[model samples]
Target: MNQSFELTPNRLRELRGFAIAARLLNFSRAAHEAGCTPSVLSRRIAALEEAVGGKLFLRTTRRVTLTPRGEQLLAHCERLDAVMLAMAAELRPQGGEPAGRLCVHLPGAYGRLCVAPVLARFLAGHPQIRIEAVYDDAYVDLVAGRIDLALRVGRLADSQLVARQVGSMRRYLCAAPSYLAAAPALHDPAELKAHRCVAFSGLRTGTLWQFSQGRRRRSVRIDPVLSCNDSMATREALLAGVGIGIQGDYMADPLVAAGQLARVLPEWELSTSPIQLVWLPGADRAPALRALIDFLSSEL
Candidate 1:
């Protein structure tokens, strides 16, 4: 005799709730994806936890993080992407050429020295593409600022946005020959405290210069005689023999070779920071932005 049983889909709902929560790793964000309130999402997740007999997330005031069980389950679930591009002749118009205004952001010095030249070629190649480039040292919110793309330096934290590393950034501790001659002998990073330092007020790491020698690392707090937020002004001060300053490779390399500035602390070096081409979460679906990103990654 066959046993009478009612088939239920509570498990399916539980799986879906768990999947969205695990992907976003935040109740609010996952709730947005599920088209539900965060409180409702929380209850769904709780029901899922009870059905699975384990807690799936570690909740906190700041953020929600996945537990081991959540990680394992997420590893098996298919990826959910914000950007999906379908390339087909059926989807193309008479002229499928991508054309539009593309707004981009970059650091002032990096944009002028490195990116502008490449962007020049990209614009020349695409006649219909117009660009509005904003150069600022401050980090701008892609969504709030309505920026389509940006070139970023250094390490990036985990985010829903996509990043593609294109190149590297190198910084050096440098001074003019006159300043080095007038200043005291500076062989170690500890000596920076004794010498005059030109600080860039824009450094995310503050006034301290961090260095690494072999496996050992050290950070020295700087006391600057002159501080400037502008890279050009800082470079001028370093060239004027006012004080030692950390300079980007683009500006320092050419000048150093010409004997305008000397690189200090040759033994201790700053790690190479990454140059990333970053964009919004769903921006890959945009043809113009995608082309520009590809062009930059290839040229740079």
Candidate 2:
């Protein structure tokens, strides 16, 4: 007869490995955290599954996923981790600045033009906090992407994430003054078809440019001579007098003021979007995250 299963010290270590693996959903990452090899983690997890009599994870080539049993176990593991952290904090000195890794998601141009500068100042103050900024305009799954914060511009769909209005964003049709000088005058929005343009590759394949003034909205289909995914690259093309570019207010203003770029349609009002700082609902309480929010709210 097999001996009755027991929750020994070794079993507790195995559970901890399972928790880390489930949180990251990657065996290698979990193994790194445990300071061991992936093969070691695999054997321990196999043993744990045999002892618990249930499959805790489904390992695939692309990713390691949690099974239904794993999900339940993960929740319990998280609660335990929270309790242990709280207990440990109480015993240790409550000194020093908030210290941890913060992985943030940001739009390319906004990250480079706006948020990156702020983070430079922010990191100087919180030297203990480590930051990783991933720039993209596409949607990111906070949980799966391991993102602690995200800055987005525009209306947010109703979701589980909590958001705060941090600033504002406005688009403008702009071009180099030299380009405007040599090219035919563009008096109306419809005239963009006759002009060369710099387009963003991120735009939907068949998407058309839409503009508005007062209550009237117009859409135009224009061919782009240069298409790019990076905002900075597009701005550089615009500076070289390549074509008209749709740029955010923050990006266009300085160039316009410096005589490098000029607004194409001063009479038209481009749609504005709200800039929001989004995160998990419970993330506000994190000392590092809270410090960043306060800094941005005041600065932005």
Candidate 3:
């Protein structure tokens, strides 16, 4: 005889955990998002598997993959999630203030230097809402990570997501006054080959720096004396006069105004990257999400 599966609150929690784990395909990441331990998540999945009468995932040392059963359950869970969100929207009082958990993903240095400063004011305005901010330079899937919103810088490639251009990011090739004072006279982009440089490992251009003077374009290949993956680290190296490097205007402008750094080849310009706020469609229906979006759109 087969046992019937009942959806108790505990069972619902277990199913939610299963859904998150299935979406991420990694127990560790799923656990982190679920606000629980991996062992606890594993146990929840085990209980869920027993209730469903089969294994949900095939786990190995390298990766996790969903079983056929898990795929079917995930489809149902997604449908349920949509229904719950819609129901909540309907039940909310008209003109009700937004109140809920809002998960946001942001670029590491930019979030700290720009967005982080404005969050306190946002929170003060929406006293009922709680924010979970994840700062990282890596791109994460909004659906898989269960993120409500993300701030991205550069040309957006994800056509599936709705994006709003909040501002523009301008990069400047700059160095400390000390470095420029001692280094050889730097006039043209091509002359960069002779100078010691600092490279950002995360830049798509790699070691090839591109600049434009009107319609004239120039690309220079530089072997850097130092390289860093983090933007803050690169900025520190530049401040210490390690070598000349490209710095974003948001970070470089204040330093430049304060006379800490000097621009190199001011006549040439780097491509401007767009700063955008992105989210999955229909996600803004939630008042809290909409409120945060509006606040950031105006602030940033």
Candidate 4:
């Protein structure tokens, strides 16, 4: 007769750690999400390995890969996670106040300039919920990162995640009043090549600036005097008369109104990027996640 396996509290905790580690494939990140240290997470995985009578992950100094056994275990863990989520949904009271820890991913500059302000109000209204906001310009895999929600700005590719367009942002070619006053007369996009440019590394077209007027489309390659991955840093450089660069209307409009910055080629238009809220599609949406989505949709 085959022996029956039991999942005790400790075993379940270990398995949960294993599942998170498997998804991330990075012990440090898994440890962070699991609310434990890397050493503790490693010990849990080691304990799990002993219980299963096999090594699950092949760990190197730089990377971690799943063994065949680990892959099989991960498949089981996924199913278990789905079951648990569904069960929680069923057990939760209908129309219950949302309360839990919600992890949110946000773009660095937009999050600070736009989203960060409204968060305090959201928290004030929902006192039971705690938020962990990770701000970065780089795209992250939601599932791998175990993120509950993310706000992205730009054209989105088709993916398995569910997305809702919250708003749109207009891009403008802009520079400080100081830079524009002394620099070359820039009546056209072509003139940008002759001027010192501060390039934003996060732009989809890299250093190529695109503009359209009437029926004419222009693309100009700029050799930047300075390049920055962070939009806020780029804005700071532009404000200090470093060079001309693209700035989101939200960031530049106020400065322009204050006479600190001037718009370049106001006649031409740059394409607008949509702001979206994205989350993994699942059978059960936690009430906290739902509440946050609705709140941001209105606030943003």
Q: Give one clash count per candidate, in the order shown.
A: 0, 0, 0, 0
Regions more than 4 Å wrong, model 4: 1-95
TM-score of each: 0.72, 0.68, 0.70, 0.70
User: Candidate 3 at 105: error in angstroms?
Assistant: 0.7
Model 3 spans with C-alpha error above 4 angstroms: 1-90, 93-95
lDDT of 2 by residue, 1-300 (tens): 026656676776677778878888888877766645688778888888887678999877777788898888788778877887787566443584777789989998888888899999999998888999998978788878988999888877634466789989788889998899899988888999899999877544323778888888888887899988877898999999999978888888999999999999877766688999988645666778888888888888
Give Cα-based local distance difference scores for all models.
0.80, 0.81, 0.89, 0.87
For 73-185, candidate 3 gives per-residue lDDT tens digits of 89989999999888977866566778889999999999998999888889999888999999988889998999999999998776556688899999989999999999999
| Candidate 1 lDDT trough over 10 residues, lowest sum | 1-10
The best-first sequence of candidates by lDDT reads: 3, 4, 2, 1
- For residues 1-300, write the lDDT of model 4, one tens digit per residue: 014345876777788889999999999888766656788889989988888888999988888999999999999889998898888777665666677888899999999889998888899988888999999999988878989898999977634456788999999998998898899898889989899999999999999888999899999999999999999999999999999999998899999999898998999998899999988644126888888898999988
Candidate 1, 198-256: lDDT as tens digits: 98887768698899999989899998999888787899999999999998898899999
